[model samples]
Each structure stands twice: as C-alpha cells, then as structure tokens.
Target: MIRVEHLCKRFGDLMVLKDINAEIRRGQVISIIGPSGTGKSTFLRCLNLLDQPSGGRIEIDGEDILAPKANVPALRRRMGTVFQSFNLFSHLTVLENLTIGPIRLLGKPPAQAATTGLELLRMVGLAEKAHSLPDEISGGQKQRVAIARCLSMEPEIILIDEPISALDPTMVSEVLAVIRRLARQGMTMAIVTHEMEFARDVSTRVFYLDEGLIYEEGPPERIFDHPQRQRDRDFIGKVRSLSYHVTTADYDPYALVGKIEGFCEKHLIPHRIAHAAQLLAEEVLGVLLTPLAPPRAVPTGQIVASSALAGTASTGPPLTVKVTASPAPSGPTHPDIELVLAFSEKQRSLEPRLDGAGPPGNPLETANLPDDFALNLIRHYAADIGYERVGERNRLRMRVQSIAGREAVAPIPLVRQCGAGLGGGHELDSATDGDPTEPDRFGRLARRTPATGMTPHQRLSS
Candidate 1:
C-alpha cells in the first residue's frame, strides 16, 4: 500500500538516507536489516513522516503524501509505529494506553474503544494486565501492550523499529511471538531489527541496507542462503578467520598455539573445541609439516638439517596455516572450525595432473610414519580431513570437532629429535627468532615475511 522512489533524508550537513526506493505491499511483512548507523530506523521514520525527507517522493495508495497540501496526519492515521523504547504513557493504565489512540484520533466512543482495546490485548496475551500501569508490567509485557496499542488504531500498516533491542534475552521471544502472530494474521509491516533468524523466518521480503541505500532485497531463502553480494554473504555467514605463516623449522609452535587459543576465546568457542584446534595446529605445523620447512642456520654458520626422515628434503616452500570459524549451516549453537595448511614444492609441476582427480588421496597416508598415535590422534579431533592441489601449492583442510563427552585423547609425547618419521618427533623450540606480531581485525598476521615464489607441489602427490 506504500511506494517510495528516490527517497532521501538529511539532517543538517549529514545525509542518512540517499535515493532509497522500496515498496510495502498489502499483507506483506518487509524487514530492514543492516549494520548500525546505516539509517534503518531513519528509513522507517521517513515512511510515516516522523522524519521529513530532504528530496524524492513517497506515494501512499497512489497519493503523493509529500505534497504540501496533502493531509499528513490523516495519512499517518492509516499507519502505526512502535518504537524500541516501548513508548507507553506512564500516567495511563494498560487499558487506557490501548484505547486513547482510537478514542482521540479515530473518534471512537470510550466503551467501543475499550472493547477493541481488550480484544487486541487478548491477542497479545496481555488481557489480564489491562488495568496495570506501564511501570507495573515487565519489559516484554510493556512491548506487547505497545503493539496492542498500535493495533487498536486499526491502521492499514505498522512500522516497528528494533522492537526487542531493549528487552532482556528472556523477554525478546515474547515480543517476537506477538509480532509473528501479527505476520500470520496478515499485518502489513516494515520492521527494522537485528534479529537475523527472526527476520529470515517472518519476512516476506528482506532488505539489506548499506551505504545509505537498499543494497540488496530478496526473498528470505535467497537473502539468507545465497546472497549475490559479497557484503551480504560476509554479514550473513558471520565468517571469522586467522592466518599464520611458518617459513623455517625454527618457527615457534607455542606462539602459533597461543594465537589459536586467543582466536577461539575471542569468538566464544567452547573450551573443548578450542583445545582440539590447538592440538591440530601443533600436530599439523610442528610435526607433520616440520620436514617441509627450509633449514635454519646456527650461530656457528652451519646449516641445521630441517628433517632427518629418509627421502624427505628441506626443499618445500613455506607453509601457511589458516583457521576459520563460522556458525554451522544447521544452526548457531555450535560453530564449525576449519584449518587449512598450504605449501608448495618444485616437483609436482613436472607431472601432469589428471582432470577431476579428487585430492590425490589423504596426505596422512603418504607421510611415512613410524606409529599410528599421531595419525589416530589427528583423526580423533578432526571430523573431516582432505588434501587438494591448487596450482603449485598443496592444501590440506581439516574440520575440527569438539572433544566433549568423548574419550579423551592424550597429547602425543614430544619427540625433540628432528624427523623420527611423522610421529611427533619434530622439535618445537621455546626461543623465537622472529618477533610475535599482532593480527589485524580480520585475523590475518601482520609484519611477517612473504612466502617465496610458487614452486612444485612436493609434500603430497596428486
């Protein structure tokens, strides 16, 4: 019933809404979502003329409401707004709050207004509190009353702004339940909220606001599952990642482990899961890939061998470890952690790779081992592991799983002597030749030496 075209809103020198265009169809629930300060609330206010536009046109029912002679108040009567703060009159009783709008604006008789108010109150499951004052009720109940009050006016459409932002976690669901019921009952609404799952469930159309405009708009499935824009995908997926580089055999394993732990804690991952991630980093970098690192030179100017494992040479390029954490596709209760190890060698380029050949098989099988402890321990903590060749680099990906409630896997005994096979024989020195550096907000390590030019893939055969 409402259509906006090239709508713009400005306050003094700052422009908030720029050339915004959207439509709210009858019985359609449209949800506006985006980062803060993106003008989500400002857009809602402009629709009801609570915030006047600096330019552009808004047409309600084919009538240009922005016209000077158009009846703004009369037009607004057809639209109701519910604010985040539950703007209920303190002096009025619950029943009075619901009835006053209809009585004063709609010109309804007191008894008729009260009867309608009581029905709306019942719809929101707050009829028993009809006589209670706003201050006497809980935050959730207050918001429900506010919604019922908005509905008592019998408006054609409603605008709700961050309806549950101020409520406690326990109270959020109650207010959302009321709104869900409204959506089911065919209430045309434009809601600006941060509740992603709720918006995905209830909205007929989702609007992603960014850069002061409707950056993307689509059905819930398309918006949440397969957003076409990069920003939308990043925001929807909630992806967080960290990367560390290992150039030489002397690279400090403890520093890498500490970084992993800090990343997990920052993301609020479970302790069991965090421990598993640390173990994976230690094994993959310190033990499994130690033979692949370039040799280091000692103070005596003698080059220390990187690996003592037979047939294994220190000819492989530097390795990069990347850790990414994201909410599971099924739900958000448990997040999924991914570990990727990438390194290149000079030999793989000499052989032709078969098309569609999957992963050249798992690297764990090819790495000659003396025992199964390290291999089995790796398998215990990792839910899935695979190897793939991308260009000259060989990448191994592991999906880390939680060890909670499962049989505990003890850490492999450290083997200080260089390569005694791929069985935790690699040494992890406590002294660091390179200084520890801070990672950027995106979790990528900074002030690190770049990896050498791409060579052949030698660690894993394709």
Candidate 2:
C-alpha cells in the first residue's frame, strides 16, 4: 500500500506536482495521464524517495517512510520501476539484465541469482530472449526484458513511466499486452501512459494530472464519460480526437462521430493518423474525404438531427461512417478507440479542444466502487452508442462509425442524466441516486453513515 498526501515537488522555478494526495491499495492498477511535462515521472520516483518530495508525507504500509529513521534504499528495493526507454544494459543479454540487480544490489551469488533470474525471464515471456542483447531485439521485446529485470527484485509494486510511448504504433500494443498480462497476475502497478484504450481497459482507477495537480481521479468509466472538470474533458477530447480522428470539427467540437477536419501541417513521427489511415485504405477507397475538407469536397444530401426526438440538438454530421469498436466480445477485451480530428491550417474560431473541456463550476464525485464495476459502465455505454468493437482476432476491432443511428443512451451517459458532467465511479443503488451511507468494499461505512442500525455490510452465505 502507498499513501501520499499534500505532495509538492519543484525544480528551480517550476512547480511540477502540487498538493497531490492519493492512497493506492494492494491489487490495484492506477494509471496517470497528462500532457507533456506534467510531473508524472517525478511522482513515480517519489514513491521510493528517488526524488524526495519537497514537502509531503509518504507511507508504506503503516510506516512513515519520509521519517529520518527510514531506509530509503530498502524501500526502493521493495518497489520496482520500469521506464519507456528500455534502460536495460545494451551490452548484456536478457539473463544478465535480471541477474545484475539481484547480484549487485542484494549481494547474492551470481549462480543463485541466475536461478531466480531465469524464472523472472520466463514470467515476462523472455526466457528465449534471455541470450539476446538489447540491440538485437524489437522495442517491445527489450521492454519485456526491462520488466523482467524489475521482477527479479521481488517488489510489491511496479512503477511504469510511459513504458510504451517511445515505441511505434504496432509495437505499442504488444508491450501493452504484456503489461495487461502482468496486471492479470495481480501485480500492483502505478503507470503513466498515453494509451487511452489500454489505460481504460486495465486500470483499477485513473488519475488525470493537470497543471501540476491531480485534476481528477476515478474509475475509467467515470473519468472518460462523465468527466467533472472541463480541463479533464479537453484533455480526453484532444486525445480521443487524435486516436479516433474520424469526428468532424464543427459537429460539437466534442461530437467525435464523423467527418474529421483536414489540417495540413508538417507533423513528424509516431506517424500522423490521417496519413496512416489513408495509406491503409488506399487499396480500397483511395483517400477518404468529407465536405469538411477543402478544394475537392463532396456535399451531403440532407442534414439529419442527431436524434429523432425534439429539444436535444444534433451536434453530429450527416455522413455517417461506421467502424466496429472488437473481437466478437471474446478478443483481447480492451482495445483503444483511437480518433483524430484535424482542420484546414487557415481555419479559426474553432478549437474543438474546448468542447467537453469547457470551464464549468461542476466537479463529479463518485464514492467507493467495487474493483470491476467500471467495466459494466463501459459495456452499457459501448452497446448503446453504436460503438461495435472493430479490429481482428486478439485485437480491439472497434471501428469508427457514422452518427446516423447513434444517440446518447439512458442510465449511462451520466453527463446527460446529471445535467452536469459527473460520474466519478460508484453505482446508483436506486435508478435515480446512490445513498451516501453505504459501506465501501472494504466494509467501512461512508462518512455520511447514520449512527444507528447500519452495522456495516453482512457476508452473503452461499
């Protein structure tokens, strides 16, 4: 268990993390996300006092780690960390990577450590790659080796800092799959990532960091759908736009269903979304286009309202292109729904980033939710929103589709139900609301519990 409170870290004049507080429990996988330079790496290091917090309290189990009597190095050994850059020694083989930490740090005999080292290698599926040097393998394989090296230490928690961002698009999924596998094995992890689909699927909880503070934190469903803060919404909107790229800019800016804005710019590496999709579709459809693009645009027949009902407006466009969001519901289970929205370089008065992320006075608050309850929220939303999973076998085949028959569904889309964007995680006991007095999964009553008759929850005898 890790407990951090009022954490603040500053380098020179820049304050990277501010007033951050969170409690991470065992068997939980928490993913942190933010734009570049938002202090994600710093926070990870602070877990083991790698970068001592300027002022904050850190506790491991029940001990005050920041206390003068605590052994920082010992604490670090109890926690393992992996980086995006395969920090594996390029000159050494995979076996050497795992053995080095144990032999050197734990002062174990090389042969004895090798026994454990080989076991660790197999855990990350790299026993065959054991003799291979870092330079001789793929990025994903090298990262696997790095992970094996960390496991050799037998740590309780793993801290991964953007471990897949440096890899190419195809390789990203392979590495994420390995991490997901690790999660299944019940390793507690605190990860910093940009892979929205991966994070959404595997995370026990997610934290959105903004301006050096924890802007929002909750289950994936709450954080993704009923985001409380506008900044948080903008962060996800831009990310989803880039991942999906199919939605139109004028629709709702936040609509994200059809007709992407075509912007011309010299954006380099990690591959541009629009260009990649064009290449992938070239053999079939040449280059995809919409009325939103310039010069050689095609016009639509008649505009349709987003829904047939009245009052609610159609922030979506007419040209409905559909993509399945899947693996027959039996595939890898969690795949990212990537989308990107671009526009003409000359266009103005339209920065779609401001859509759902608009500044508002509301903040979502969801009480304690069971470990896997969020997945239910996702399935509920995905089915109704016309989001069919669209990739191949062992993949998240959910595709981007047109907004023709799509309308926000009920009991989900808490943003529409609440009239305020807030679904921070807990379920509503009644269809209309959730009582604040219920006990959390750990059997502790909420702060609002009444003094009488509520004797925690009872065990269900099967």
Candidate 2 lDDT, 136-234, residue by residue in tens: 889888888888888889899999999987887777877787889989989999999987778899999999988888889999999977789756766
Question: Which stretches of candidate 2 lie above 4 Å from their native place?
Answer: 239-462
Clashes of each: 2, 39
- For model 1, residues 92-127, the per-residue Cα lDDT tens digits are 999999989888988999999999999999999999
State the RMSD for candidate 1: 14.4
Candidate 2: what lDDT? Answer: 0.58
Model 1: clashing residue pairs?
345-456, 346-456
Q: What's the lDDT for residue 430 in model 2?
A: 23
Query: Each model's TM-score?
Result: 0.58, 0.55
Worst 10 residues of 1 by lDDT: 346-355
Which candidate wins on TM-score? 1
